[model samples]
Target: MSTTIAPDRPARTGEAVPRATAGAVLGALMRQRLRRDRWQILIWLLCIALLAMFSASAIDQTYGDANARAQLIRLAIADPTIIVLRGLPQGTSLAAVAFFEIYTFLALLAGLMNTFLAVRHSRAEEESGRAELVGSTPAGRLLPTTATVLHAVAVNAALAVVTALGFIAAGLPAYGSFVAGAATAGAGFAFFAVGLLLAQLMNTSRGANGFAAAVVVLAYLVRGIGDAMGTPFGDGTHQRSAWPTWLSPIGWGEQFAPYTGDDWRPLLLQLGLAVLLIAAVFGLQAVRDSGAGLIPERAGRATARPALGGVFGLAWRLQWPTVLGWTIGGALGGLLAGALGTVINSSIADNPALSGIRDAIGRIGGGGSGPLTQLFISAIFSIIGVLAAACAVQTVIRLRQEEASGTAELVMSAPVTRTRWLFSYVAVGVIAVLAVLLAGAIASGLSAVAAGEGASTFGDSFAAAAAQVPVALVYLGVLTLVFVLVPSWTAPVGWAALGLGAFVGIFGGLVKLPEGVRHLSPFADAPVVVGDVDWTGGYWMLGITVVALAGAAALIRRRDFAIG
Candidate 1:
């Protein structure tokens, strides 16, 4: 009976069978992703941790007296623009002021970290054809997305732990430190979900990243505008609008108000939103085809226009949206700076602690300008300059993307010379950086006028913004050289360079680094426009930029372009 084949037995179908369960596949993918992304995770965690600690420690170092701390808090609370930029002032304690000044920015940084992390592991993998390979195996369709999101969760969890430890080590209250770290992590997780959803919606990683970044910017602006427009009729209390804080994830985390009082409730909202978004991601992935997005891509012109025949025009066409986004962000930052500038002076002067802090910052670079002016301009423009440098590096890195996507080979196969092609993109990066800087200046100038600085002071605001351009150009040059020489390492090396420069430039005085090391930042050497104009330093930086460009142009002609 056993030897004879059973009459009811069916033949095998010969279809491929899965050998692993969903959990098994997910675990494998998670491990693989962690190994690949460990460096990025480490960098983001270290940056946020360092920033939190530094800000806290600096406040403790600068304002040891209780009365001066209270005075500084009162001044900060009274400034609507400051409230808008930094989120609502927390408690009157020095720790709360530190939280008020830096929590929003920390949230912003976390959002960025999550955005890049999620996009790279999801849409980027799909775009590069790795997702399809994984799909062909025992892995279920949702496994990859699930694994990526979980990886983000793990990374953010680590960020929270490290940040809490950093704050505590910096002498902040332990409970508030923990809450602040958790809030920051919550914001990051929310953006991580947003980025994942965006990856499913936008076909290309670049578009997904840009859209996600725009959301971060929009979140900040919405929170700012809401805080600034607080109802006048809400009694005599300093209670500004609290509703707007609920409208954004960043706001939700920031309004948790660490160190002031722990408001743990708003974090529930962030968690809920993240849950909703992650649920949507699974639904969208189930319906959409691999390597495709839920949102349909628009078809382009059937034939190339006359302007598109040139390298410059093509470069602009590809990167114009990126340029526009950075310009708008820079302009908004400048507007906040100018509006705050109008009030920050009297506020600082009235507070001894603030005045001393300002004077010390002034002494860092030869004490030529009024301390208040130097403090305001340096603080504002330095941030704008760092952001501009980021935009510049991104713009330059597009060259690498083109090469990897085979677009460079096609364009080079045409009658164009490599030198011309390379220069066109380099020119675009240079022009884009300058455009963003100018836009920031003009916007700041206009805001200054609106804030009663008068039309004459508009020129001063413009100079203040323009003075930051040399540092941005230095970043652009560094990135371009990296792209041409070590194409594989462009992003990490380029961004790391910019990050280090910004770190040293911003906190060098507070951290008490050697003067020579402090001046190593290109921005540090550039004259604070609120003080004196160092034409010699400016010319030197410009010359260095030129030299970098010359080297990149020469190198690209000889090296083989990378292909996917």
Candidate 2:
């Protein structure tokens, strides 16, 4: 017991120990990161492949014959909204149609996957103190950053290979498949670099993620507008050239027109932009001190306001940034919906090529004055409703996070009861969801009017946006039930429900699923406000949400608080 132990130190002999090379240090860090992130990487790769393959598989069934394929190309080229949502279709070939149908969205998915991955491996590790632990040893200063960039590269490369093979398996030409996959991967690489640069620039991981997500949203908006600008709407006789598409990195993939133009030049542009971003990331990283951001964080107020004394107000303060982010995104999405809604009629009015799509909307809406516009708005609102649910779920889940972090104990130890504390956050979440939905409605209404639609259309847009609130509440209710019943499964179950609902709602039409099966989605059951509103369905949904929240409150009072 009296024996003294000495720290492991280098020998005092005249000889110096050889230092580990940067490669060796980086290699070890990469190995550790791979082990930690292997499953996440696999799932991301699988999702990318599956999304691509699913989109490709639907092309044949959607357009059965050469004439159908030709019509699709014509309708797509004539519609600025189509080009805005999807990329420009360069040719009338089946390959071109498939590429156009899937690439824009797939590129978006790839970009998001890369962003999350880069942030997790770079800023999140630093935030959690893991990076410092690793750096305490013989590791070099740039090892962590280098490892993260390499991990992103490797994952994106795998995504490219998988996407190419998926296209080939779907019977696309090898050359086209390779080029499209490369373009997709190139888009991801550029965003991955963006995430890395943001990580160095923002003071917190949350800030980094928010900033990066904002950039992604901005890119999508710019590309959508630019693509919309590329075409003159009406009879498609007058064409206008626009440069915003060239300015957006996300727009570069569409410009490739993989199967049609087989243009490889856009890939070079993507790579060049990525290379410059990566270079800037390193330069920025080198100058910033460890655990500090390039931009200094501002100090907070020295005193809390009276409103902050209550749990409800505190919850709002903490979740406001997230709410703001979603609000901005929803506003932008609404703008797109409004712009498209305004032009939807002219785009499909006289085109025989678009008759089938028009007819489908007619069938879905039971044939009204503007059934197609209603269908489009309903679809947009459906997706937005799901996103609102997601945002609400994140907000409510902050309760569990607070509990796990031991902050809830401190708050509850005050005069607040468990019920008040729990419902306070839930109330804030409900308010946030409502605000976001309303914001989207207002933005859509204004944008539609601005886009030259009648001012009355704003009322329709607002009604459509508001009508989806019940469905979003349904999601909130379901997730709250999960949080109360099975705390650990809250995130997975909540997100899975949203994902499954969206998949069913979107793909049900493409796959020609049974009407009964399609109606299982809350969004499907919810009435589109463009026609008569289904008050019965909305009321039932609201009732269910109220019941779930009541039950959750009761349960929170009985159960022991969870800890990490």
Give the TM-score comparing model 1 with the true structure, all chains together. 0.84
Steric clash count of candidate 2 = 0
Q: Residue 28's C-alpha lDDT in candidate 1? A: 80
Candidate 2 lDDT, tens digit per residue, 170-232? 778889998889989989899888888888888776678778866775776678778767755
The stretch of ten residues in a row with the least summed lDDT in candidate 1 is 6-15
Per-residue CA lDDT of model 1 for 408-512, tens digit only, reads: 888988899988988888888888888787887888777877877767666766776666777888888877888888786676666656765765566556434
Question: What would the C-alpha RMSD of candidate 1 be, to one decimal place?
Answer: 6.1
Looking at candidate 1, what is the lDDT of residue 472? 86
- Report every candidate's CA lDDT: 0.75, 0.72
Q: Model 1 segments beyond 4 Å from truth?
A: 1-19, 92-94, 226-241, 333-381, 415-419, 445-455, 493-520, 557-564
Measured on C-alpha atoms, candidate 2 has an lDDT of 0.72
TM-score of each: 0.84, 0.82
Q: Alpha carbon lDDT of residue 67, candidate 2?
A: 75
